[model samples]
Target: MDTATASKNPDTRSATDRGLPWAEIDTVLFDMDGTLLDLHFDNRYWRELIPDEYARLHAHEPELARQRLFAEMERIRGQLRWYCLDHWVRFTGLDLLALKVRLERHIALHPHALDVLDTLRVQGKRLVLVTNAHPEVYAFKHARTGLGNHLHRVVSAHALDCAKEEGCFWERLQTVERYDPQRSLLVDDNLAALASARAAGVEHLRGVRYPDSRGPAMQSVDFHLLESLAELLPDRRLHAYASSPV
Candidate 1:
């Protein structure tokens, strides 16, 4: 695919035109939630359901429970523990994994995400799923979405004892799963993770413009912004696909 012309909109086209060496990319790293899958599930689970469950368990008002939980979440916002269900279980004295299993219905792939995955598979790209999600959380989502079947490997940042935001995480990741940073592309929803990967020398980087399907689109990004995964499809195929009915 010629990324420059495959962009879904003018803003994305402008970003793609900025000399991205897409032809040289061999390894494609993907972030799980938001990048490939819809992020609404995670947002609602953490912001709404968790607070409601906490209130039910603690005999507190929903608003009070939300305040307390939000405070704790904020304290560890960017830390590894923030993505760990085991850490949450210990912190909240609640079975988080079980709760997640019950809420599995909310899990879903982003629009045209499967189409993009299929295209990458056909193109023989080395696909890798990288996420900050804890092993239990990753397992649940992987099982629910079957995203693992499409990838060469699934990596949890917890395995490296660091969040993707940390430079050390990339170093640790390289040692475990070797890939040339210069020939690789990483598509992630988190700007911090993309920045970390860039610092680690990953050549091609793309960010999802709307990580949360129900939320407003992001303003401007330093790297290529993908409005839809369909934007990565081959130009001729994309044109035909777009013209087809839903």
Candidate 2:
């Protein structure tokens, strides 16, 4: 069926169709860390580097320090404090911002991420990055990768004073970005965040199954998955988009 015909009549499409109605969607809300950039850098930073640094700085045994840190992290997994670098600096007495900058070489974008961003831009979609990463973290990654250049706007959940996993985040986000939930799509790796967006009336959502290249691809029980952003744009002309610098 023709694109126009299929877009107009949903009944005409096959049951197995995984295609999104781009004509119906105007705003695309993206999660920065895992959705656009590789999540391995974060996993390693929090799980390995921070623990080692904490042990070194506080004179605690390495294993015990990691264990203590993991427990604290689990305690606030979905809360705003979990994603706050300042909170960690105070909790661990370590200069986390400096450490993050030191490990800047590890930061990177996921496969086909640039192509997807450029394609969405060409489609005239209002791309907004809605991330839980602290502004400092986002600022560094933005400077490193120029991901912000392709986006129309970037909204950190920190600005909204809540984590994306919180149900209120979507509503609070609307105050800064007037995106229609019915005509918007949110792409994130966190299932909890996706659930919160759904609860806030977002009609479309997508999850990245392979946010951490080093880890096994994950499965989402509640949402369709994209192993790579390439799945979002299948146009053969995307080769041109991919060649464009971020």
Candidate 3:
């Protein structure tokens, strides 16, 4: 799926119909933040709350405070201890998760992302949400999106007890959901997460860059960049079932 197909027309190629040549990816593994859900909340959590707290603690300019904190956080983003928000809070003496939640309260879903999931389910594709969010944050996101009822299962990287950067995290995912990797497709906004899945042998993976992002765009995954899930739905032929009335 090219960027053109993202807003132009449906590819008319279901994972199998495209002659994907894999075992038939009946299972579609979806990432929550930035993939299905918009990254606005997470971005705000870091860009706002973290900075405000840092300024309060250090008595510095908010921008300088945030930049300093972000610099430190980025240095260890892929580290095991970093994924554990509590661990970071303990290490920094700041309530990381609590601060994150304050910002997360404003998160929302990308246009038509959930509609694609509904179409997938209606098409008989097994749906599973694979994310790195902790249980509390996960609940907040799901409730806000009204998507919990549309999925078959939700698996978090935390549940796997590891960060998605690790190969073992992908390997462990196999145990939670019995899906053929060759046939399975993983979608995420994080390049590392996509690479980890590809390394685990899931062939039809995609990375959706935030449409208006100013950060490092994820290009490590295959080039199927989608800005909206509406791109995957069938045309008027299945419009009624695939999307909300326009």
Candidate topping lDDT: 2
Worst 10 residues of 3 by lDDT: 1-10
Candidate 1 lDDT, 126-205, residue by residue in tens: 89998999887887887887888888899899999999988998899987789999999899988889999999998888
- Tens-digit per-residue lDDT, 1-246, candidate 3: 232234344554447443332236678888887878777677777666666777788775766766777787888786655656666566557877567566655676766677778877887788889878777678866766676788999887888887787898888887888888877888777777778888888877777756324345445334566545565554445444324432
Q: What pairs collide in candidate 1? A: none
Q: TM-score for each prediction?
A: 0.88, 0.88, 0.79
CA lDDT scores, all candidates in order: 0.79, 0.82, 0.69
Residue-wise C-alpha lDDT for candidate 2, range 31-138, written one tens digit per residue: 988789988899888878898898887574767877788899999999999999889988899988788876788899886787788888888899999999999989
lDDT of 1: 0.79
Lowest summed lDDT window (length 10), candidate 1: 1-10
RMSD of 3: 4.4
Error of 2 at 188 (Å): 0.3
Worst 10 residues of 2 by lDDT: 1-10
Which pairs of residues collide in model 2?
none
